[model samples]
Target chain A: MKLHEYQSKNIFSKYGIPIPKGRVATTAQEAKQIAEELGGRVVVKSQVLVGGRGKAGGVKLAKDAAEAEQLATQILSMEIKGLPVRKVLVDEASAIDQEIYFAITDDRASKKPVLIASAAGGVDIEEVAAKTPEKIIKAYIDPLLGLREYQARDVAVAIDLPRDYWKDFTKIAMGLWEVYKNTDASLAEINPLVITKDKKLIALDGKMMIDDNALFRQPDLAEMRDTDEDAPAEIEARKYGLSFIKLDGDIGCMVNGAGLAMTSMDVIKLFGGEPANFLDVGGGADSKKVAAAMRIILTDQNVKAVLFNIFGGITRCDEVARGILVAMDEVKPSVPMVVRLVGTNAEEGRKLLENANMITAETLADAAKKSVEAAKKGK
Target chain B: MSILVDKNTRLIVQGITGNEGLFHTTQMAAYGTNVVGGVTPGKGGEWVLDGKIPVFDSVKSAKDATDANATIIFVPARFAPDAMFEAADAGIPLIICITEGVVIHDMMRVRNYLDQKKVRLIGPNCPGLLTPGEAKVGIIPGDIAIPGNVGVVSRSGTLTYEVLYAMKNLGMGASTCVGIGGDPVNGTNFIDVLEMFEHDPKTEKVNMIGEIGGNEEEKAADFIAAKMTKPVASFIAGQTAPPGKRMGHAGAIIEGGAGTAADKIKALEAAGVKVAKHPEEIPTLL
Candidate 1:
């Protein structure tokens, strides 16, 4: 659940955070029109959901409307980090006196939302934290108390900001926190919170990633998801209540739990086979969901072999076997298949699949080794 | 001698009238857990599962009736946090939440309340722990566990089962196995379980299963080096996981170079723990 920069800025504006006026443009003419209205000088940014767009040449500064249109034309037709530039933000460029980095993310160790701010801005903050270390300051906001005035001041002072801008910095920080809390955002960041020549602060770039588990209450935020930003198989997998991530290799992994699915992938690699994709049917997955999962995995042409490694606790092996039987009839996949069934009703499930032309393994290690050999043979 | 639940763990199932609640409750009782009763709000005064278990309206009433010291949740996400808070208030010392998708914000509040009350919460998204042949709680299969001295702690559901199966394959049975859940924030962590295993008399060796996400594994490595005297073997998943893309679990992601499997492996190995390159290597390493 990642939001594009323009989308993030839209949410930021609602919280009273200052942002440069910008409009999303699908075509170069729209970008030029927005640039002309903003007095010609503007930054054309690709609205992809990945970082390093500037390094990938998806971000460009134009001196005037003519250059804005040319840059937009170049950016709109290009791809950055495998994401196409379907839309670009034409934003008014401002003169910056200084830049600062600011963000709010969940700290797993503390189990609280932490505010990370630094005086050094407009670059990779992780790099800064790794290199300088002391320049970056993190403040954990108490959930009940929230970002207190003193806590906000700690970040500002730690960044070595002038006393005159402390109050304004606190206001922006609070606003950012509001956006994060209200949107159910896992992460909310504003890189290069710039100080203009006149001493007014504005967020030059914005990013927000909403927690998927909290989407039930945040319907409005959920609607902002761009399916175009996701792979088609991934989108299809979600509809069936299955979690899927496409990978490069020959073996397709289908497991029940998230941890098991990752282990299935890792074991494949360890056994000298690369995983084509990661798929978790999730607990309580029924026959229909299992069929849907197989259908989605079969659509991956890179997958030459399919492995079913299930530890059926909440997810019964019998139900999974039934689903595979149903899928085998529908998909009729030509690739080799290997399965290792264990736990509840595994004997019945294995009985159901015994007639199918699939190799069965006694252990996960055997399953991985067999799947690798079968996949390589198929290749 | 188990780390958490054992032969004495009397259990209450929250949302007991629901489908998952009834299923696992029946299984837990069959596995010899003293599943006393259950709570399903309006379904009080009724009997479920062929009238073998009593049903109460709230955790307090259930506790009063069953003398239940522990409770496991099977409620939906919307009511999970409230069920947890109610169980804590009802004086249940051990709370095992099997309900996945509990809101992160709700967890924060529940965690704070649990800290004040000195309660042990495990897995809002986890498979509850098992103490081999003695007691079973949550959803881990009872048949695979064999009574032995190995202690296992994991952040994953299926991977824990895989590791336990591996140990069982090599004639190494477990004392107890705990899945702390795969969410970014959980009720318990690796260090907590490791510390418990360090002191447990029945446990001889320890197995840790970690994946991508926060630096918890790295921190746990430091804890093992500083406090733990028992031999520890570890395995980390998601070495091929792409950076910035979450691999299924909310917490399993390679972000900011902190949660990479390589970094965690390097840290854990530096702490004198035998790090398994694969699951099959774990039993040998230990």
Candidate 2:
């Protein structure tokens, strides 16, 4: 889940990371109050998950409280990247001598947590990677050993920090890693870890992505989830314990496994069809789960046909057939359905499905063809 | 042969006392998997599935009794990492974590621990894997998979089944199929499974289904370009999803031009992997 910049900075400050004092405001009056409390120049930023907020005019600099309120009013009323600004973060602006980037995130290939730092900051990291990859230095941390003094120093030196600031930089890097690990964040980034004109280092901007799975362990962080920014269908799917991804195709796919769901979509495309969504009911889903999945898929007006492909191993084919029947009963789908059942009790499951008016395929290819045809006919 | 599990592979189900664990374990046992035991903390010393498998207090004891080489987890996301670490430390070579919602940080720690111990972990939020007619270890529907020559690997579980259904309709059967999971910090990746598929002689063609997330697809494309000898047909989902929205998979978000489906498709196509524009086109491409 994504946290707003102000929320992330709040957590960062709690962890001893130096951040300009900021307040989150939902109204212009609140923003003005925050700007007045800061007593100087403030930066008004929109709270959205998407990037390029500055380019979208979601961010503005204010000389004082009144301008800050005006800017907040403007930003809060505007939409950036299709997401409306629900809140504005009013923060004290910093004077920077140099800007640097630092982040800690998981590196899947190395199966380790990696810390990334760059001397060049305040710009898109992808641009740096594309234009000058060497400027970015990465350090893979040992989980058991944690981020050591030497590892943090290596990154500090790689970013060309002055010798006097190396120790401070190391402390900051280690602290950032600690915050990342403690918060269960998938990503914790500090962009423009600026060297103030006064020569003190501080994090100008903070961003964090908390791991959804780990939310159970961190109730404090879990509350930061912004359901307002999430897709409605996804929010509903979560309630039903279904893993649903809404796609743009016309054929709706319902499968029991993630791998199977992707391949089903691939095969649909192979047969000149497009999948409207990726819905996995998970292993041993009962009729209730199936009904919930159906409801979620039917919400998508783009779905012209539905495909049910079941390979009953740990999941019984008969149970799946029953689930489909229950879902069909509850949803009363106008679209056609093509089902392919195999594995243990598959024959029995197929027998149950055969009683329904829906088309049944002996193989996935036949099922795809039928579903695609059904979808095209609807189109 | 299968890439992960077979009839000979002894299995242990973590969180076996849960509703989901009990349901799938019974199905797995009925499918002829050597489901030797289960782990559920204090619920140990009980029988979960008709007294066929013994339930133990922990993975260590389960391993001691069953000599289980592989584990399939059905625990909640909160306990998933600890379950994975427990199994890994117990020397379980293959750990298929079916639990979802494991915080990425916990997964990172679990993955790091697994790596240090040289353990192979499949997913923390993924549908487990199936070897097709051998031993099905994941939540994937079994009936769609017909043991054949095509190897299927995907980030999306339901999409994998759709691919299998298409392949089967086209008279193409699967040798082994794996869902590497859709979380951003999953244990196994597309490239890791692709490397395994590359060496498996039973796999005639590979169907790789990817979604928007990370640069894993691009990395897989790089591996396929350099070493893969088999024909690879791939499809990337979420092309229609608006830019910057978190589509479906937690990891499938398009962020900062890094994990866009279009970017992945482009990379896969450039790397000589046959790219499918839609889900229905995979069979013909194969």
Candidate 3:
């Protein structure tokens, strides 16, 4: 649930964080108009989820509206990390007295929200962390207590802000934390938080990753989900309520659980096979879910074989077998399938599958061997 | 013995009375979980479920009445963090959040709070967990697992069951299977559960299921190399995932040369864990 820089800045402005005036444009004309509105110099940035947009020529500076339009046109036509630049943010360029970086993201090990700040900004933070970890200052916050004033001040001081700027830094940090918490973001970052020639602080660039689960609570934020940014298979998987992750392998796996799916992939590899995708139909999956999963898997042309491993619990073995049959009927897969069914009603399920003229393994090892063999044959 | 839960663990359902909440709760209770109560803000004092376990308005009240030690949260994503915190505040030792779409920031906050409070949080987007022959807590098919020595841990729910099916085909059953969930800032991590599996005598072999995302697998790989005494077989999904596309799991993404299936496999291999390249290879690796 990553947000474009413009989207993040919009939320930043709502939180009282000062940002350079900007408008997102989808066309060269729109970008030119936005640049004209901003006057003087403007920055044109691509609206992709991945970083390194600048390196990819997705971020450029324009001296005037015409140049801004030209830059926008160039950027929109460019592809950064395979995502085409559909829109660009035209923002007023700032004269920086100093550049700093600030961000709030999850620290999994500490199980806390950590705020990171650095005096060194406008470069990859990972490089800083790798070269001089001490240059980066981090503060872990208690969500219930919120980001305390002292914690914010500690970050400000650690970043070596001048005494005069400490107050403003604290204010910005607090505001950003508020935005991070309230927006249900996984990450809220402002790189190159500039100290202008007038000594006023402004967020020059913004990046945010919202929590997909929390989208239900923030309908406005949820609408920001760009389906065009997603892979077609992923969009279709979401529509069917199936968890499908396309992988780069020869064997397509359709499994019943997340852990098992990984292991199934692992087993395929151990047997000299490569998995094509990770598809989980979920528990209590009906024939419809199974059909949807098969369709998604079949979309991967790299998939040479299909593996159905069902461990029935709340999901009956027979039901999974029936679903596989249904999906096979719907998909008419040319690839061979190896199924391993166990748990409640295992026998009935095996019998149901046995009648289908598909390969069935009495054991997982047998299934793995058979699937790998079937895949090799198909290949 | 199961690490987090067993037959004796009493469970409470948060967000009961919602469609998914009620449906999964009913199925869980039927699977032999000691489901002692449910909680729905205004719908308390009513039995939406057939169980004798009372419904309470709040987690605190439910804890007081039921003396429940574990909670399974079926609340929606927005309120899930609050629900987790509520369960934590009520001193529930183990909280399994079955909700999806919880904001990672909210999870980070909730997880941080839980750390401060010393509570165990399971998932924000996961299907939950299941200890075969004891209790079922997540969305994995209960019939797929049987109480055995193998411990299964994964990020995908359906994929976990698939592995179990493969294992069952080998006449291998599971001591416990856990889906740590797919969100980036989840409560329980792969290393956390791996440590638990390492310590559990019932867990003879571990099937570590990972997907494309963060450095969790690499971290677990390091742990497996240093700490794990049992045989660890690993599989990482999304080897073929297209660049710039996020798979179903929020954490299942490849970016900046990190969170790739190849990287994870290399790390796991370096850790001395047998790596399986495909789902069906897990059984052979074990």
Q: Where is model 1 more than 4 Å wrong at Cα?
A: none
Q: Give the TM-score of candidate 3.
A: 0.82
Which is better, 1 or 2, measured by TM-score? 1
Choose the strongest candidate by lDDT.
1
lDDT of 3 at B94: 95
Q: Residue-wise lDDT of candidate 1 within B6-101, one digit each (tens)?
A: 999889999888988988888899989888999999999999879989999999999998899899999998899999999999999999999888
Model 3 lDDT tens row, A350-376: 888777878887655567789899988
Q: lDDT for each of the candidates?
A: 0.90, 0.82, 0.82
Candidate 3 share of real interface contacts: 0.59
Pairs with backbone N, CA or C atoms under 3 Å apart (clashes), candidate 1: none
Which order, best to worst by TM-score?
1, 2, 3
TM-score of every candidate relative to the true structure? 0.97, 0.85, 0.82
Q: Best to worst by DockQ, what's the order?
A: 1, 3, 2
Candidate 3 segments exceeding 4 Å error: A245-252, A262-276, A299-305, A313-340, A343-357, A362-379, B1-69, B73-91, B97-102, B113-118, B121-182, B187-212, B215-245, B253-286
State the lDDT of candidate 2 residue by residue for B138-211, as single tens digits: 77666666788888888876566667766776777888888888887787888888888888988888999888
Q: Please list the residue runs of candidate 2 whose C-alpha ends up more than 4 Å from where it truly belongs after superposition.
A: A243-284, A297-379, B1-4, B124-158, B161-179, B187-212, B220-245, B254-286
